[model samples]
Target: MTRRNRRMARLALPRLAFLVVPAFLAGCASPPVRFYTLGAPAIATGAVPTGIVTPATPVVEVARVTLPDYLDGQDIVVRAGNQIERSATGRWASRLSLGATDLITAQLARGRTDLFVTDQPQSLPATWRLAVNISRLDVTRDGTASLEADWSIIPHDANLPILHSRAAFTQAGAAATDGDTARLTQAVLEQLAERIVAGWPR
Candidate 1:
C-alpha cells in the first residue's frame, strides 16, 4: 500500500476498537434475577407460639392449591385493567401452584389451636382433606391486590357432608417494588385463610 494509505489505516484501527469495546461490554452485562415467595415473614424461633396437639385432634391434610394457567408459573404479574404485565427481574421462588398451598397450610395451622393441619404426607391417615382452588388474582403495581378462591372441607367418611365455600378478598397497599407486591399477595392469602378457618366444619 502507499505510505499515506498505510498511516490512515493504522489510525482508523485503534479508533474502531475503542468505539466497539464499550458496546460489547454493555451487551454482555445483564440484570440479576430476584426471587420472591408467598410465605409469611420470618419470625424469631422462640417467638413463634405452638399449639397443643392431642391424639383426639383431627388431622387435616392440605392439598396443593389449583391455580389458573397464567398464574401457575413463577412469573410475578401485575394486572392493569384488561392487560397483564410480567416483571422483568422478579420471579416466584416456588411455583404459585405449590406456594399457595404452603401458604394456606401455614396460615391454617397458625390460625387454629384445636386442629392439626399438615401439607406433608403423614403415616397417620388424615380425617379431613382441605382443598383450595384459585379463580383469579388481581394485582396492581401501586394500588391494590385481590383474589378469588373456593375451598372445600371434605370428610374421610362418605356419609358426612362436605362443606363448600367461596371467598373474595382485597388488600389496599403500595406495591411499587416486587418485594412489596409479594408481601401484598401474602396479605390477601392470609385474609382468605381467615375465612376458611372461620368456617371450620364440626
Candidate 2:
C-alpha cells in the first residue's frame, strides 16, 4: 500500500519472472531419444560331403557363372511389405551372384580337386560347368530367412546337364542387420556346392 513497498514489489516481480522463464525453457529443452539398429549373424556352413573322390587328374578351372540381369537391376527384397534400402551408389552389387562366386572360390580352396582356372574359354580343359537358377531369396520380419536354387553341372562336350539338382535352405534369425542377407546367400551357395560335389559322376 505504501510507496516504498510498491517499489520493492515491482523490482521483485522482474527477478521472479526471469527465474521462472529460464526454468520453463530448460524443462522444454529436454534431450531427444536415441534409436539403434542390430545386424544379423553369419550363415552356418553345413556338413561337408563324405566319400569325395580326388580326381586322378584334377581339373583346375573356374566356370563362368551367368545370372539374370534383372537380379542386379531389381531391388533386393529384404522383407515382405518392406521397401529395400537403395545403395548410396543407386545400385545393388548383385549380392546373389557375389555369393555364387564366393562359393566357387571356397570350393576351390578346399583343395579336394586340382582344377584351378578362372577363364571359361571353350577350348580350355574343364570337367564340368556350373549353372544356377535363383528361385527365392528373401528376408522376413518373422525371423525367417530363405534361399532356393536349382543348379546343374554339364560336361563341356555334352548339351544336356550331366547332373541336375535343386537345393533349398532356410534359417530363422532374430532380425535383419548388416550381412544377414549375405549370410543367407552363403548358405544357399554352400548347399548347392555340396549337392554338386556329392552327385559328381563316377
Per-candidate Cα lDDT values, in order, are 0.83, 0.52
Measured on C-alpha atoms, candidate 1 has an lDDT of 0.83
lDDT of 1 at 175: 79
Error of 1 at 54 (Å): 5.0
* Clashing pairs in model 1, backbone N/Cα/C closer than 3 A: none
TM-score of 1: 0.81
Candidate 2 positional error at 165, Å: 1.1
Model 2, residue 7: what's the lDDT?
A: 98
Per-residue accuracy of model 2 over 1-202 as CA lDDT, tens digit each: 9999999999999999999999999998845432211111232222123334343443434444446554434244455565444322122344446546546544543524334323234454566666667676666656576767776766766664567787777776654543455455455556656665566554
Please give, for residues 138-197, the per-residue lDDT of candidate 1 as tens digits: 788766999999999998889999999998999999878888888888889889888897
Candidate 1: where is the Cα deviation over 4 Å? Answer: 1-24, 41-55
